[model samples]
Target: MTPSLSRMIAQAAGRLTFPVKWFTYGRRFRYEQPQKGRGREFFQWDIDILGTDSFAADAEIISIAASFYKKLGLTPQEVKIKINDRKFLQEKLSAMGIDPDLTLPLIKVIDKRSKVTPDNFNTMLTDAGLGTEKVSSLLNILDDKDGYKNSEWLTGILNIIKQYGFDDYVEFDPGIVRGLDYYTRTVFEGWDVKGEFRSIWGGGRYDNLTQDVGASQTIPGVGFAMGDMVMEEVLKKCGKFPALTVNKTRVLVTVFSPELFDKSIELSNILRRENTLTELYPDPRTKLERQLKYAARKGIPYVAIIGPEEMEKGLVTLKNMSNGEQKMLQKEQVVKQLI
Candidate 1:
């Protein structure tokens, strides 16, 4: 195997609804050096349901994945992802007289299909203790797994995932060994519809984790992860990443003095009602210009001032930070009038 570590990040969800086995990625390797969206050892957000068995988790995870990609500006049409269960592979292997227990080493070699030669692949399988018959069987299975022309397993898998309501988000593939010994049921990978080399994220069912870790419970779960690195790469390849500016908090509501505190409070309350995020100045003696600069520096959107002229007639002034537009409002109407 290429011996690389991969990470998948998912949102916090309670009680997963899909069966996902543990996926042991290739050798432990991390790039400490920095590059575009990557580091030698960057934190890769991982979301997995180790021990809950259900399809609800799969549905929720896939939906969230779709939502995240959409939020990142990828259309469903541009990205066609695929998912399947490891059980199907095991079943196929069993049919070919390959003991499921031999899955580990064989999987390691299969995962290395990209970086190795065909002759080397054969030698690796022979070293893994597969007889000639077993080798021939494996080769046939691998070759036919990618096509639906004559594989019964492919037919069954396609029908099954469709029933799970993931017909659109998943497909069957024999070549996707996933290289994880514990992946009991489903596995998945996200890819560009055009067959790009990089994928944004992918994962699937694992039902035996809790039991394997010495728990008596057969908690089956399914989930996937998207690393910020690969997702960024995929986005960059697609060429539509929007400029990500640091969104700030804290809107400045000028406090002319304690006299204007009540007015500020009223205006603040009104702003809250309209869902306009803001903050009233805490210091009592800060000057108007100082507060305005503070708001501008902090990137605050709106500022309201209750000066003596407006305060005398029960009025408040609202200022827009970007365009310098000032709006006058009645003191009593200030809170309700400025949205």
Candidate 2:
């Protein structure tokens, strides 16, 4: 992560965002099946805003996440971005008289809260050295209804999110302590409304991560990562995924015979020169029916056939694969129609 982040910073990106494939070994055997959203291999879309510590930066990150959901045609009712701050959590714990040394371990337990049963989660918390009273207090903090209401950092970011018209998609949830220790503040995760799937993505502010990676300068950054597997699943379930279509070769030039192959090639080139995506049938010996079938299979909408007679007439036969409509047109007209 540091290597990629460093490269983005070096490239002068004010905010870096991209999808990356990641691999991890689940050596601890936390769960049996690596199905649904959790797996050893996955693709994550990461968004990071570096070199700023302002609350506006945090708001911008959240807004970007909201924009992504909007682009996917997901409404606020379909998805929610839960946010919390590590600094706030630490302050709460310190006020509760919990040892700072035990905070990280407790956070790990909190991260697994949804994965384990309540009894098992409590046992894990106790095993991590929290007494019964402290456990109760911690649970209260985690479950507080107005946890972020009084938090200046959170409210500031929330106000900015409202300005960006994404407040409906976001909310303050104190339970959102990202599992990673590198995160210093503003942790968040995207969740399905029904809670039927694992988190779509999770990330937060990691102010000191760059310094930990041996960078001489400190780069305060906030970001999130969404795995492709979970996102794809959610989009399909919501019927938001668009119909897949062929993006290349909008027009296919069919070779009628060996003798007129050059005419087909020239037609394809001319169409290509006019900014049209054209594919030429490789073998002139292939039957015209076979070429048309290939174009249909590839979802190429238009096919241009330059046969012996059509070549002699300085015209090409254009077939619309969808409607089976055919017309004889001059080369310029064919190009115009295809483009």
Candidate 3:
């Protein structure tokens, strides 16, 4: 099993809590190369707050995930956070007289429901040592729309999430029994609304993880991790990918000719001093047309050309590559105009 981050926190005198890294490897045969979301090796963004067992901690964690979606420009209509409590699921199972040992195996099967056919899923449950009668009851509970409607834990945490104004991005989901024995309460998964992609991310409260690993005491925690692959696909589908640009070059200083190369270099240095992102052409002998084309190709929005004619007047020709507009500006005015 992967070592518990919670245990590490307790040993370190509560030094680290939020934004931990959990590096893990998955089987290549199952997680094939170049797939939309699956891969052989990946890192998970595991955010957690230790030393508190309050449902408020769970609410705060969920709010952080909703805030992240907002940052990515994903509307509630485009994605949602599905929430459930493992304790609630265990309660329902106990009510149906399910053997405690079979709970983990049963959850693992339910976790694969969307991937397998209904018949195969039922067969897997039977193979995992569940009798036909218990399997029927379990399936009914899993299918019940109102299964979690009466859960006080779910109700309380959701009310807190509403106060954070993230209710639109979340809903009660009994089927989300995160496939892990460590998670004791408040499990969740972020899903794409269109259902065309896999889960954007998922996590839950693992109150026992610290003690399970080796700690003498438990630390309650909650967080989620999103993979870059699925997030990129979702952004592309929603047309929310930000416009790409060369980060260091908002303006390109083109070497108009060998004779005027020094002027271009000087102007670039001035722009840099003014806190502008500037790139200077390295080759003085490069053609003006070729240099301008290079600037445009690099997504540089503006270009400064210091040819002999402009140099004599101590002026520079500023061109807006996006609109193909050019104007003559005094050397002193270049900084103000470009800025």
TM-scores vs. true structure, each candidate: 0.72, 0.86, 0.79
Which of the numbered candidates is closest to the native, going by highest lDDT?
2
Cα deviation of 84, candidate 1, in Å = 3.4
lDDT per model, in order?
0.64, 0.83, 0.81
Ranking of all predicted structures according to TM-score, beginning with the best and ending with the worst: 2, 3, 1
Model 3 stretches with alpha carbons more than 4 Å out: 1-4, 14-34, 41-46, 238-248, 255-266, 273-275, 283-290, 299-301, 306-328
Worst 10 residues of 1 by lDDT: 1-10
Better of 1 and 2 by TM-score: 2
Q: Please state every model's RMSD to the true fold in angstroms.
A: 6.4, 4.7, 4.3
Candidates 1 and 3 compared: the better one by lDDT is: 3
lDDT of 3 at 335: 87
| Model 2, span 1-339: residue lDDT tens | 534574546454444443221222222223346887566676666667777788888898889889989998999888999999889999999999988998888888898998889899889989998899998998999899688987999999999999999999998888889888888989999998998887788888887876676666666777776767788888888889778754678899999999988888888888888999888889999999999999999898999988878978898999999999999999999877876
Could you tell me how far off, in angstroms, the CA of residue 217 lies in candidate 3 after the best superposition?
3.9
> Which stretches of candidate 1 lie above 4 Å from their native place?
1-64, 99-101, 115-123, 130-137, 145-169, 193-199, 248-251, 298-301, 331-339
- Top model by TM-score, which number? 2
**What lDDT does candidate 1 reach at residue 41?**
49
Tens-digit lDDT string for candidate 3 (1-339):
224566667687456544343333333223566666666665445566666788888898899889989998999999999988888998888888888888888888888887778999999989988889988988898878676668888888999999999999998877888887788888999988888887788888888788888888666667665666677778899899778643657888999888877888889889999998888989998898998889877788899988878988889999999999999998778888877
